[model samples]
Target: MGEPDVAANFFAKPQHLVKVNRRRRMNIWRSGQGSPTVVLAPGFMAVTADWARVQPALARTAQVVSYDHAGQGFSDPGPLPRSPARTAADLKAALVRDGIEPPYVLVGLSMGSFEVRHFAHQYPGEVVGMVLVDPSFDDMAKRLLKVTPSDQVWIESQFTHLKRCELAAKAGDLRPGTDAYAACVFQPQPDLTEALNKTYHDMSLQASYWRSLASEFSFAARDKADWPLADMPLIVLSAGDRERPPRPPEEVEAIQRVYADAHEQLAALSSRGARRVVPNSKHAIQWDRPQAVIDAVREVIAAVCGGPA
Candidate 1:
């Protein structure tokens, strides 16, 4: 575990800072104002900026917050082995420390879904709604291994390369292709500015971020368990378009089917839970189809804010 320390650095100019303990302080960004705050959690190796499109849109109608997980972006590194439970706890603590009281609408993207789901499970009264965008479900790794062996290899290889990059970053020698990796993950952003592009590149090179991602991936299966449905609105957004290299059409179709099935299973977490497919989107739905994410959040907000049931 990381030792408690003061948040002495402001190198990144974060909008809000909350000390979790003597050793860690979380950086938070906030916009707009209203009840039932919308908390946005970015995917693996991603920062709040990844929500560049959806967060602003959602903020217009409600208070929106997006923060860096410890060790990602401007946040300080936290304790090791960042399990979902610990991550969820950290988020709760940060919210409390900053006086951002519940009820909150937790919106998580990709790997972030695990943390938000755990948060709702642990603090049901605090979260009024949830929006899971292209979430990662339990047993995902094993399922992928069985259904698409080649795709599994590709996934593993990507992680392995990230691990190497982490090692290189630790040695003060960042590996090549940082910009390329950034481009690959954050592509199709015609609106990205030069400064934000540099920020993304810098974040991708952070060894701590990669380490956090690897830990999250390693513990995913171990964290699998039945999640009780909360009596709140829930929306699971799955991508209609799948990203893949040239492969057998049947294989691609099989993988897509499995993913869609998994997403539907997530919607079963609540009585009000529903699944929606974002047309022409890949895994990064916020980036691929920001309106889909915005709409889902708005729907949940409306339901929670007494607009409709």
Candidate 2:
């Protein structure tokens, strides 16, 4: 079959672009209607569509919103570095400009945990509950390094690869069938529609996309002090089936131990927090175990709404 018209397919769905500021506009997909809105925050380089399997189901119960970060998906590029604080501020501005009220049940995936946690910390009154899906904890790399120091080489190599992709995209040399493309761009996901996959591919070719990803990846590894989540309801979902990089079995076990401990610490941040180990799921728990995410969101919503959880 011939390639699809990605632009047409991508635009077929209604686009809601809210101006976060004069220089920045964010694209958001909102659905359902109820108080204590559920907001889905995507991981590093992930767009709103990544929550395709989970968002709709949660929307059935409470107002649900999924959005792309600045320089991602259909959103306009924002300031550089894309630190968690900056992303959190952009999200708050976008939500306000879009007229989505607070008292939210924030659902964060992977690196998104950083942004959502920062958002909650910044404006605790706005966030009533949180569901962290296979989250990245504060200073996770540093903590893990203490246990599995050998992974330093792997981490540096990954960063180098990201830089190369950024430069290639800037030079307009990251094309299909090229080594850079193979290394930088992921293959089409089987779960997404052909048109969506095409849109993802086209977006990957943009220099801004690579720049955003590289910036987020760099900041994500930096050490950040942990803070309390107060008594708000929180659920930390850890991926039981996380894939390990090439490493010795003992080293891998050590890393997993550190990971589990970190997640436990995250849950402990809240008085009402709890942690769960999701089986048969990889890092993208929403894709592998959407029901887990849906259930977690529902649970948080119920708690916030003073209903059974």
Candidate 3:
């Protein structure tokens, strides 16, 4: 939100943006001058602006750059079957267009993790480090993404609740003069004025609209990453709590076991691999525990960048 308008002010001069003629501009939104460039890949149904709270802080430490994926956020429509391969290409092209010279610390969340994972595996030299915030591994995640008729109910419920929240915030029904706004802000979700809520909601709604594109590409073969090892300094932050419906004690145990296996496998692959849990957080661990994420990224940079931060 601020970056698009403030790009000129933040960098002391109007930042020039050029559309990517290649890839049909599938990747859009680029600006900023900084080193050790940080490319933030957002989770499913999220826009780059969703990172507003953390970008400024990250900008202070490094040149932080995040963009809306194709068919999501403010970006143009993307191709069908929004697989990891296509997303990775968009990220690569976007970075190149912005003149963000390589050696990036790719940070991805949720489905966006698929993009970063592919990016790292394909272009190892370009990536200096990796920060996966509750990333979904390709093989493991695909199983859950499989949509069934029942999945529609959960999806519809979330959509309705989010839209209502957006409307309430936009109408000023909740404001400083009202206890509603105060209480809403203190609630588990982000502090959104009705207007801000609507804006963010539009971003989410737009992203979800492209869910079909993801589906189209769902059954395609993976891009052949034998071992996504993540050889560089890596920080993997997984959701701390598995507190959702369908979670019987046994189910929870199974999830923990899978996560544990994933963590252990990464450790065996990289000496610098580190892992942490975003305490009491849900699937949107980044939003739920922003500070913990920032801290984890700092550690990754410290490990990879050298010197005492």
Give me the candidate number with maximum lDDT. Answer: 2
Can you write out model 1's per-residue Cα lDDT over 56-75, one digit (the tens) per residue?
Answer: 67777788888888888778
Tens-place lDDT per residue, model 3, 161-185, is 5445445555645555565454333
For candidate 2, what's the RMSD?
3.7
**Candidates sorted by TM-score, best first:** 2, 1, 3
Better of 1 and 3 by lDDT: 1
Candidate 3: Cα lDDT at 32: 41
Candidate 1 CA-lDDT value: 0.78
Looking at candidate 2, the ten consecutive residues that score lowest on lDDT are: 1-10
lDDT per residue (tens digit) for residues 148-216 in model 2: 887688789878877888899999888888998898775787756777677778788888888888789
Each candidate structure's count of clashing pairs: 4, 0, 4
In candidate 3, the residue pairs with backbone N, CA or C atoms under 3 Å apart (3 or more residues apart, or in different chains) clash, namely 81-213, 81-217, 169-194, 170-194
Clash count, candidate 1: 4
Looking at model 1, residue 115 earns an lDDT score of: 88
**lDDT for predicted candidate 3 compared with the true structure:** 0.60
Clashes of 2: 0
For all candidates in order, the CA lDDT equals 0.78, 0.84, 0.60
